[model samples]
Target: VVYQRIGNIPGVRSASIVSGRNFFSGSGSSYGLGFVLLDSFEERDADSLSSEAITQKMFMRTAGIADAKIIFFTPPSVPGFGASDGFEVRLLDRTARDIRDLDQVATEFSGVLSQRPEISYANNSFSTTFPQLMMEVNIPKAKEAGVPVSDILSAMQGYIGGFYAADFSRFGKQFRVFVQSKPEDREEADDLNSIFVRNTQGEMAPISEFVSLERTYGPQTIGRFNLFNNVTLNGGAAPGYSSGDAIRAIQEEAEKLPADYDIAFSGITREEIASAGQAGIIFALSILFVYFFLAAQYESYVLPLAVLLSLPIGVAGAYASISLMGLENNIYFQIALIMLLGLLAKNAILIVEFARQRRQHGLSITEAAVEGARVRLRPILMTSFAFILGLLPLALANGVGAVGNRSIGTGAVGGLLVGTVIGVFVIPVLFIVFQYLQEKVSSKPAVIHSNETKPNV
Candidate 1:
């Protein structure tokens, strides 16, 4: 029913209901596993027809299914990092609560999280709805009847759980044998009365006399994390929000959980948290390396500042362009920023290096600066414009990997455009200021002649 309904949704290319869990199913049972494929970018060209928008529609349309919990998420940007893109949280129960209580808490947590503005949806697969049979052993009675506790357990295991009996080798193959009662023989609670175990005296004793059975409800499987029972909640960020925002929102709301309850991240969320803020450190290191390299080339520690200071103009333009285009500051964008940093620095170097040479040749700082800008203008424009034109296809990329391509291309183009145009004007002025300061600091005080000084003394 869900497959049919979701398939009918506009922009959904197809919807499939898979019977078993596959590699990409994440960390849970395969029950209710469904996959949806959306139309290609060409078909869904409008904001209203986007994947997020279509997913929202599906959510609303399927909200009427009260018997099953359905969650929709994009595939993880990087495979093996997680089951899906967004946040993977494990709600830990450190107090050793009953399975039913755990289910209640998980449901409540999901409900609370769903209300948060940052989260698009939050749901857990941990359920206690499967019918179960609970059994209690009467150890003393079994011992008195000469029917050992192991014998009783063996009888039940063989009849209900199916026992592994033996293995046999065939024509280049091996097979294991299992012992179990007929399906009908083990279908009801009363079947326990029919089960019999051998006593020590070689007598047959009914196992029901040494055990009790009761109907119950519990999950088919339980999960553990950090040595404690846990329920996993899978969710994604709301529209206009990033995964980082979703993670922060989850952490804030987790504080409201009861004592002994905690939250931990897994898969991509763990990776995201671990890698957070690393970009800034890396960018700083890149700048440091460039500074030292420039210092070595010019043999002046002070002159590097003139080149580094002009970098922000390019970086700022990169970020502004991406933001205006509705792209995130993702890895590709960061990569572009780094590349732009190098290109911008190179442009500045062309002007600064030339200006410094002119200054050494006896020209005034202002004259040297103006001449540098004039001489380097043609090459700077030609190289910068050529690079920008080369990235045009990527900025307007379509189909597979388009988002990443656009991110890299748009950022590089925007940064170079701003850097080359404004940087051409700014670099010379910066060189003039820093070069003047460099000369002043390096100059020594004038000395009087020794012949005149000796007579005065």
Candidate 2:
């Protein structure tokens, strides 16, 4: 039924259903799986035919399914990390309590996440309603019957669940054998009465007197994580939010869970959380590297601030543009930010380097600042506009890899546009302030040449 329904979805090119497990064999308890192949980009040109849109349609179409909990998810963009995109959170039972209790707590945790605005969906496959059998051994009854408790259990294991009897060597090969009762004799619980076990007296007795059977319910399989029983919740971030935001949201909500329960991230979410602060660190390091290079070039420690301080303006511009464009702060956007930093610093360097040269040649601080801006303005605009125009195709990209291209292009373009337009004015003022400070703190004035004319402002 689900296969046919998903096949009928507008953008689905093909749909297949498989029983027992998915292709990756990741879900041991999953009974059935469905694969949907979407139409090619050229065939599905409408915005409604996008992957998210088709997934939403699938959810709406399958909402009437009461016998099964249907979940739809996109495959992970990067392979070997997980089976699907989004966060994989393991809800751990540290004390190894009853499976039913774990199921109850996990369900409640998923429900709480579902209500969070940052989460699109939160659910787990762990279930405890499957029919199972409960076997009880009467230890006292076995002792009274002159039979050992281990003997009865060994008999049951051998007859119902099968046991490794022995290994024999034949024709230079080893053969292992298992023992189990005949299918007809093990058809029902009452059949156990016919299986006999020998007591210490060498007399045979039926095992029914020493064992009891009752129908119960439990999960078909249980999984452990970090050596504790765990239930995994698979979910994605809501629209307009990044995976980082979803992770933080889950962490905040997890604090409200019982002390015995803990949450651990796996796959992409784990990688994201593990490297959460790396971007800021990388940015700081990149700036420090540039600052040191500038210090060496100018042979002064205080002069690099004029170039480094102008970077925040470009960073602010990049962030403001993405927010206005309804884009998230993802890896591609951050990459653009690093590139933006280099470009903006290059523009600042042109003005500051020129202003320092004029100061050494006998120009006043204010005159040198004005002269530097006027001399470097044309080349800065020319280069900045050329770079921005070159990225226009990427900013308006379509088809494959469009999202990443757009992120990089849009961020770079926005940052450089704002930085170049405003930076020409700000760089000179920064140079004047930092230059005055550097001159005041120095022990001697720069070697001024009286033969050179003063810089014209």
Q: Write the per-residue lDDT of candidate 1 for residues 1-457, one digit (tens) a residue.
A: 7876788777899877865453333433436577788898898877787777898988888899987667787889888877887789999999998878888989999899999998999878778986777899998888888888877787888888798999999998999999999999988877878988888999887788888987887786788889999998889888766778889999999999989799999998998889988999999999999999999998888889999999999999998898888777778999999999999999999999988877776677899899999999999999999999999999988767888999999999998998888998999889988887887888721333444445645
- Weakest ten-residue segment in model 2 by summed lDDT: 22-31
What are the per-residue Cα lDDT tens digits for candidate 2 across 1-457? 8976788889899888877675322544446788788888888778798787898789888889888878889888788787788889999999999889999999999999989999988867778987778889888889988999888888888998798989999999999999998889899988987999999999999999988888998886788889999998998888788888898899999999998999999888888888879999999999999999999998889989999999888889988888887778999999999999999999999999998888887788889889999999999999999999999998887778777898998999999999999999899999999888888788534657775568769
Question: How many steric overlaps are in each model, in order?
Answer: 0, 0
lDDT of each: 0.86, 0.88
| Best by the lDDT measure | 2
Which residue ranges in model 1 land beyond 4 Å of their true spot? 18-30, 37-50, 97-104, 128-130, 163-185, 193-195, 201-206, 444-457
- Candidate 1 has its poorest 10 consecutive residues by lDDT at 444-453
Candidate 2 ranges with C-alpha deviation above 4 Å:
22-30, 135-213, 443-457
